[model samples]
Target: MKKLVVTLALSLLGATAFAQPLSPEAKTRTLETLQQAIARRAFVPGVDFSKLPDALEKRRAELDKAEDMRAFSNTVNQVLRDFGISHIRLFTPAAAQQRRTGQAIGFGLGMAPAPDGLAVSTLAPGSHAAGVGLAIGDVITEVEGKPAGNNPTSVDQDGRETSLITVKRKADGAQKHVMLLRKPYSTIRKPTLTWPAPGVARFTLPSFTNGYSQPEVDALFAEVAKAKAKALIVDLRNNGGGLVNNSAHLLSLLLPPGTPTGCSVTRQMVAEYKEKTGKESSDPIEVAKWKGPDRKTTLRKLPPYQGKVVVLINRGSASASEIVSSVLREERKSLVIGQPSAGAVLTSIFAPLPTGFEVQLPLSDYITPKGVRLEKNPIKPDVEVANALPAKEEASDPCVLAALKALTK
Candidate 1:
């Protein structure tokens, strides 16, 4: 409980790992200093500076013996996950950043850039590019004939690619010929919201590609009220997650005050949170781990949106996006429709590095207070719906149909 309340500090850098070569001694010194900071909240002063060289001998046991990058990554990730702090992360140095200063682009599937440009990194095979002619590393060069790059003046130091780019597949090479521009991607889908039914609000979350925080949540609740909504149908068809806590916050909106949405468990004990006000509503036995004024708990004065809510989700709903669907069903009686959500609930913590970047590591396991783990297994819809049965399902989704039936009844 002393550890679970650790909140992630603002990300000082992105989750891209840097590639720095460190001697064994340097590694041990760095690890010891970092651990001391975590333990004491300050650095140990006046220590023997030369001892770091000796520590490298131990470091060689791990690095020198590591079979490959994959094995090393797995070992590091598992070790990080053991730490209950959701904010702790580690990024190894990599060649991805140093080798390419230009933005890597991809034109695959029907997926194109939005108002925000697409920084293509990886390409899925079964995309529009495969059929219309594109390669794996191909960067989109143009969209309906526009140079879509946003290459701005280098940030005084690095020639980071800041452009709306479309890379065409080179006639012979694996890399796509790229075109840079200043205009927004023409194919990018801005949210076009509409109410599909009197009680159903159909807004394309296009993707959970953006971080949804408290303010975004406030805006969502406000929208529901503005629409005079009694029941909400969140369309998470293609949405991927942005922030895990944001999703937890979304669950908080639906949940009554004092209900435990999720818990983070650490090394030796169950993690605890404090509201600075309310107490956990669960049984007394389950409440003992909670302590301290600074203890982590729910946010004070949860927004009072107790009206019936329905979440329409699919595989694209992942990470924090799944938090809503999972918590609603687990914490409240809210109906879930559409399809199963992507079962990736663990939060990614990005730890800052010497360079202006951070390493993203899966730091901790997330679960509902009731103790339901949602890692490999996603939350099953109260009712399952398949894409094949379009007409008879009436709502084009079995889950939606079931939710509507539940709400109206």
Candidate 2:
């Protein structure tokens, strides 16, 4: 089965901790592996990579100047940015391991860029951040007396250091300082089910990545089936996608058996396609006919959900989340509410590099059953609503309110 690492937030804090500067030999090896992978696996049609070798050579000076893995990754990413695509990125070994295991060696906090500084978007329960009384929506103004720019943990030392963090509370503008010790913690937030209203069941699926529990998902689906809710609200906001199999399973539960969700077009498929048609075609309908893996056929062992469906998404909803939302919207006549989804959908896999470095490269292009290419084409919600920081409690979230209101109508 094809796995997708679609989460923009997958590379979290402590990515630089324990990182060592790459030796001259290691840098050369990394560059070689990266170049070869792109040439062999990358499947963005019409994107010219003829200059990639020249570009990497041109950046050799910068790569040599990289003092740490993060710096090295940034230099490599700068070259990759030329591709103008998503799902292709370099990760430090620390970050790569965190992405796969959902564990990080830092104060467990999910942050996003705020006008003032990085804001606490998510705080894992029992984490050092949570234990220190950090709350969501709190803007981190400073870290260790330095102005907290984007990354608050840029100074962290592999879970062995403590730093004073200045935070402006969301409830009030009051600022406070707290010393937080970095430690290991789980970053996985499991899928949760709740009844928002009479006959309305809401499932907040945070992620579909590896390390996400399959039994948990099965149990949640069972609950939804047992609830017999007339309307089901699937909250996929901020869910960066994971395994394609997980997505197929989720679709199987909501969609009819044998329904076509989508298919992946690999480099081999592209080659054969162009050979047969005498030219390359970017149209999804044409690509769907090529021999490749179909998502819908990999259904999990579960009964199809028989209920009115509504999906909630935001800019962070991507990959498998985008696929699920799009398929529901198209096949089940489900109402998709909220902001536009993250247009980073593609099938990618992670490959290890020398010296504890890794790269995620897209090997296939994804097209929905309806011929819509979701790579750069974000899913526009039927009922567009501006996204906001969710309320401290899910019961009072504006997005959920909007979804419930729509369901009632």
Candidate 3:
């Protein structure tokens, strides 16, 4: 089977990807395909399959009124929200293409909600935003002469059109206007390693998504070994997760071989479990114990890291990141610091639709080795420290300071 994916980030298509409105027949076909896929494949716990038909029917008129692919996708997503679960999404053809290619058209600015406006949290290397003097901690106050909302993409432009953006600089509180054009840029954020204190190594994994070089990871681990670091801090504050294999590989570096990390409960496994146990409750422990191949185990070839470890997480850490944090806490007794992790863990896959769109549906539910269901149950940190605001420098980051204190103590 292909590696399972767990991510909340959705790739959106450029303005040029929008096409004419869907025909009546095409809309009907797309809705039916989406409904069928949900009924057959969605296995997230507490999902009501019976309500799906009515929900789609109720929204049929809205879908019919959609002017283009973007509008159609927006309405379809409303139907999907009825499940009240994560990982259920509709990707436009252009977005699907971007996902496959790992490229997106944008100014390459990562934004966060700020009191004044959207704060620039990160700038993609060599991106248009970075090239145009857009720096981290800059607050975007206006976009196209309109107030910049909380969303990061408020400054985004359609196609190659230039968007006029006004930003408040963090250094001097000076507002500056710049024109940004949307162009294809790589979406990959490579992992970084740094030493925050003596004998303490901080490894920041921006994401576990595809395109990360394994050799680069190996080199980082080599650096850790070379420094003879006594304490390792794995920073996954904004990691939304990616391939399951990537998480497993990272876990193997810190855990023993054949260690049971967790289990993925699928629809078939749930059915078989019900048949044998004769129980109706969809509890995690019962479902996870079903005799199947959904169990996750670590495989560390070299000796595991023999040092104190700390996992830093926040509201954005999700899916595979949650899995890794849970394992490190339970098995290795690692210290977890920062805010609670994002309670969005599920194994999902993208399937193409008749209208050239892709539907992402959860195929399995995840449960920790101790029977803790992580879907809605977030992993609370041992030391709950709020992350510093985007405008703050790294030296003022409370989470890192907390980790360093614990390590040094």
Candidate 4:
């Protein structure tokens, strides 16, 4: 009888082993570190940082009063809203780690703004979502048992970080719940290339930073060159952007040598200029010399794709994605299709917090060659498709079909 009881107890213990929650100490540490990091690293270009002390102190008080990690996250996000800018955000621990290390959390699913709510638009093949019958047209109504309407993505209290998603499907108005393990999605790990139509090559560029290296970017273009594609379609529809250098590398393959990509204004450089010159000039031309030049010594040797290029963008396309699209539209003469981008073009650093979460604090602002700030003002597509999401089937993508027809014309 003692042996039987012992075995049952062991089983129970094993079952509950993955259910650890963050302790109060961990919560406190996380809040304190987040406060410090934001104060030290967060910058709003053209706004004085000294004027933010009162707000920061109030946010700190709110953090102290928070009862749990979710409350703490809510308070921190509320404070971030004061900046009134994009790109600065506090990511969940799982998401923070993903951005920091290029890992992914939850099933390989991508969401887009739908009329009803955020809809699942893309799914990684053979992914957990796919295995569990999660399909496109399913709107995510709740995540982790909360109404997910603009709610920050979160993990369960259990240590597994598994995401419990409540989905409402549009096909038959059916609702279902799914459990997805936190793992890297394969879409952004490599380029998705296909020939959607004759002589038109389509490459889905999910992210500039995720898993793809410089050699891989070169290899991608080399394959494009081999296809002898007369027209190219680059997909940035759901991409949330990535490394700036990688975007530049991709743009270099389409642009002529010595093309001016854009310019950036960092908080440190601004502070130094004020300290040294004691003058604050908001004029971009006054600081145009600081604009980084795209000097390519070998781009001339590579046969640039001298074809009509079309870029697809949506509300999820942001940061480095915006930069590339804006420059390509103005410089390389690429036609943009789809809705406006997310306009999160600022340069930011992902500073990890004590509780394993990370804060993306923007330290610089990027200005396009035409003197446009890519913060709240996104790059509008030449052919503006309505925000309505397409059906799950590939043939249903109106943007892709439109691009093909445009290329043929």
- Which of the numbered candidates is closest to the native, going by highest lDDT? 2
Candidate 1 wrongly placed segments (more than 4 Å): 1-104, 108-193, 203-213, 237-239, 268-303, 355-357, 388-406
What's the TM-score of each model vs. the native?
0.50, 0.88, 0.88, 0.79
Better candidate number, 1 or 3, judged by lDDT: 3
Give the Cα RMSD of candidate 3.
3.3
Pick the winner on TM-score between candidates 1 and 3. Answer: 3
Using lDDT, rank the candidates from best to worst: 2, 3, 4, 1
lDDT of 3 by residue, 1-409 (tens): 3343454333222232434467778777887888887887777765776688888789878877886777788788888877878888887877777776667766676777788788876666666788898776688999888999897656653233578888998779999999887666776678988887889888888777755566788788878987899989998876778777778888878887777888888777778777888876566566786653355555554466779999998776888889999989988899999888878888888878878878888888888877788887889999988543222455667888998888877
Task: Put the candidates in TM-score order, highest first.
Answer: 2, 3, 4, 1
Q: Model 4: clashing residue pairs?
A: none
Per-structure clash totals for the candidates: 33, 0, 0, 0
Lowest-scoring 10 consecutive residues by lDDT in candidate 2? Answer: 7-16
Model 1: per-residue Cα lDDT over 231-320, one tens digit each: 776655545555455555555556665666665443222223335334433322233234211112255343656567777676556655
lDDT of 4 by residue, 175-265 (tens): 8888877554444456667788778888777667665577766777778888888988988876677766677778778887677787777
TM-score of 3: 0.88
lDDT of each: 0.44, 0.76, 0.76, 0.66
Considering TM-score, which of the candidate structures 1 and 4 is the better prediction for this target? Answer: 4
lDDT at 164, model 4 = 82
